[model samples]
Target: MSDEVHTEAHGQVAEPQEKLDPEVRARREAALKLVRKYGDPVLRSRALEIDRFDDALVDEVRRMGRLMHDAYGIGLAATQVGVMHRVLVYRTELEGSVAALVNPVLEWSSKDKESSEEGCLSLPGVSVEVERPVHVRVRALDERGQPILVEASGLEARVIQHEMDHLDGVLILDKTSRDQRKQAMRALREALEPRPAAA
Candidate 1:
């Protein structure tokens, strides 16, 4: 294992990912819309297998990264954005570097599991305690469509498992304890309730 870093940049690396072809970009932007809870059903269905790594898919992945940043989110799955492709954008720190994983699969995980508070963008104003592996190894494709392997631990592992679950039609709620899930749902309902118009 080398500590040296790879100095490389993808077309969609920076903030503004070349807003080419205004009309086409706009349409793709719309297609990249975040799938809000109770509004999008694909979020609960298994994502379709990704067979092609074309420009369209790359663009969508980039736009999804942008959307995640725009919404102040650290991770997002393809199904959450109405794309049934095996894709996910994730970042470890808030407002930090973002990475995209295509057709990701967890190849291994440690037996030790730790519990932590987890939340999802789709389920706003709700957090649940969930237990997940302390470490994981995943095989996926990089932004450049190159195969890559990642070994993550602690929070990184947690985020990876969370996003990977989305690809398999699983949510944090499903992993939470029965009691915690119930409480989270109640709190979510309260948070989403509309308040009376201002006097």
Candidate 2:
């Protein structure tokens, strides 16, 4: 899944409804609709390794990049879009360009850890504090199936680990403290609850 909450750290905030450009808002809404929400079985299933790196795989990566941009997310996994392929797209920064990783393997992670608040696109409105490695090394294939290695630290590392977890059917709630998990569950329940019909 992707995290859009960090956008605020870059001096960006959700615009008021009236101030939002209609086309932009529409695109964002449409992109979000493609993402599988929390409780969808696909989000809990491990993604399958992708062996074929064809034009279709390239197209999928492009589509995921567009969706991630439109949804204001830094990263997105195939599972979040109901695709069980072990693929993910991400940008190191909120305003940066996107990159794709296929069949990624976590080669190493530093022992140092740091806790940060993270939000997920699938679990909208829910934020949990998660502790993760401060540095990591990952090996994967590019969208075109070329070998690529990534060494990341801090927020970038966290984002990669978060997306990797999605590939393994794990969520931030599973990595967070019990109290935070309970709070997140409560928030999720409230969001899923149907509101009364408008008069």
RMSD of each: 9.1, 2.3
lDDT tens digits, residue span 100-166, model 1: 8888988999999988677777775566677888999999997568998999997778778888998
How big is the positional error of residue 180 in model 2, measured in Å on the Cα after superposition? 0.6
Error of 2 at 173 (Å): 0.5
Q: Where does candidate 2 stray beyond 4 Å?
A: 7-19
Model 1 residue runs over 4 Å out of place are 1-33, 194-199
What lDDT does the true structure give each of the candidates?
0.71, 0.84
Predicted structure with the largest lDDT when compared to the true one: 2
Spell out the clash pairs found in candidate 2. Answer: none
Model 1 has an lDDT value of: 0.71
Cα lDDT tens digits for candidate 2, 65-149: 9998888788899999999999999886757989899999999999999887788888877887788889999999998989999
Residue 110, model 2: lDDT of 99
